[model samples]
Target: MEEVLREIYCALDQVLRKGAYINIVFSGEFKHRSAVTFVVKGVVENYFSLKYALETLAPRGVKPALKPLLMAAMFMLKHGEIPGYAVVNETVAFAGKKFGSGVKGFVNAVLKKYPTLPEPEGIQKREAELNAPEFIIEALEKDGVDPKTVLRPPASDLVHFRLGRKGKTEDLSGLETLTRSEAGGWFSMPDTRLKELNASGKITFISPSSMECVNAFGDINGKKYLDVCAAPGGKSVYAAEKGAEVTAADLYPHRVKLIEAYADRMGVKLNALQNDALCRRQEWLNAFDCVAVDAPCMGLGVISYRPDVTINKRPGDVETIVPVQKAILSEAAEYVAPGGRLVYSTCSVLKAETEEVIKDFLKKHGDFSIYSYKNNTDFGRLIMPDGKWDGFFICVTEKKK
Candidate 1:
């Protein structure tokens, strides 16, 4: 048990200190075990709340470097299956060995006091329960979305997969039929192993919303498609599956390989390359008939899939990303040939990232206009995260000839 806590703390520490993504941290380490995976994800899902608890529990205040370790211990005491007494004792011993004897007393005192306290009240009460920061709560209110609307259970038990071009619908027997998107062809199977099914090559695991973004391009049988910020390319691959000429690009080489591996697994072919979206590529300008700008944002919409989004996110991160989103959108728009179409999408419901960015871009560039589709307003489609579909904002626009 002590050793298990040690492993959790190590993973947590890396996420905090290095700003490493928590999902990548726990991908293979504790993924198989339900109990350990819960703790690993729980610590991140409730990270800020755990920090709020430490604020009231510790008098002298925890060292900044030691905070991740203590946060792991606190989360275990509150939510983990480990006995509280054991959590305290083992953490104390480990703290002494890891951080020295001085921290042992500090660690012991904090844990012993934690279990006796009443539940947090006021801001901390809400923070602990929702794992949402005060700023986010306030922001959501301003956006006219009830923060409770974002309240959702963790990832679904159903495995989402799409069939290859040669695959058959008859193979979908006994599986749950997914709600078809504007661009159809997606399904889910409950209580199945993703690794096993993906290995079979009968299906490629991809999300419906991902393909829906491609559908926004209308008909792209032989259209040149570029996903400027694409990596581990699901949308780009889907475009290729739909018979479009796909060119996927990411900023880094390693991520390009992810796209390569994804293409190899699904038995599809597409050009994958490393190129910065922020930099101007002379020959590529106005070349693609369709472009996909799935810009990086706060990712608040997909917290259930990536729990670390809001908790690790600082207040100013929302402001910092707007320019980047605009820059990529601007670059992607330029690549859209006259009379071509471009789709701007993100895994966020934030208006600043979704509506504001699109509006600003239109104001600067008159050649593009909001191309309307069913169920989508003039700005774009902002789909809230239901347990079934990810919270995503997709807007398809046309480059006027």
Candidate 2:
């Protein structure tokens, strides 16, 4: 158990201090893999609250290196299935070996008082409860979404995938359905079943909004579609499934392979290649009927599952990424044929990523106007982060002739 806590501590430290993605951190083998994941996620989901509780209980505060350790132990004491005494003794012993007797005594002292210490409440508690950063909360509030309404932390550990046109649903066992299923869509499965599902060569594991963005192009049975930032090609493959001749491009070679692998698994074919979205192609200009730009952002909306996103992101991330989003959008607009559709989507609910980017784009591109498909607003629809469905911003705009 202490060993698992150590693993959890390292994982949290990577995400919290070293700027590593949680998914990347846990890709390696751990003795108690599931337990490590469970505890790290719990700590991430309750990060601010844990910090608040720790600070309130241990006002003098431990050093920066010991903070993650203390938080891991504290989270385990409150929420772990293991008994509190075992948690304390294991953590104290681990701390003594790693951080000397001074820090070890501090860890033991604080943890013993944690169960009796009053939990921090109000705004900090609210922030912890939501597990959202301050910038995201302010951005959502600016966009008229009440942060209070979506304050619960994420709980599910489900993977989303879809069986293509050829695969029969009845053949697969333990397949659970989600809300949006337009492109032969979503089925929740355990991580164990992924290999079995993938070996069938008729599945693509993508986010809900990945398929949703492609569905936004109403009746795209014979359209020319381009996913400018397409990698791991979810939207691109979905577009091909719906009978649009697909051309998916990403900047990196390895990512293009991911798209090809995804397409191959689903028995779907598309022209996948490595090309930077920032650079304009003369042949591609005004070519595609539907151009989808799944622009990269800080990923605020999907933080429900990837809680490490909040920790890895800095205060200036939204600002830093917005220009890139705009640049990609501007480049993508040229690829859309006259009177064709331009669909912009992101795994973010921030106005800066959603409305603000579009606002700036529309101001520059007079030929394009707000478009509607499947009941979306002018800028796009910002789905709040909930455990059941991912929070995505999808806007479908059109180029006028």
Whose TM-score is greatest here?
Answer: 1
- CA deviation > 4 Å runs, candidate 2: 24-27, 57-64, 99-102, 149-160, 173-195
TM-scores across all candidates?
A: 0.92, 0.86
Clashes of 1: 0
Worst 10 residues of 1 by lDDT: 174-183
Q: Score residue 260 of candidate 1 by CA lDDT.
A: 90
lDDT of 1 by residue, 50-69 (tens): 77778888866889767877
Across 291-374, the per-residue lDDT of candidate 2 in tens digits comes to 999999877666665767765556778888999999999999999999999999988777888888999999999999988766
Model 1 misplaced stretches (Cα beyond 4 Å): 151-155, 174-189
- On a 0 to 100 scale, what is the lDDT of residue 298 in model 1? 82
Candidate 1's C-alpha lDDT? Answer: 0.80
Which residue pairs overlap in candidate 1's backbone? none
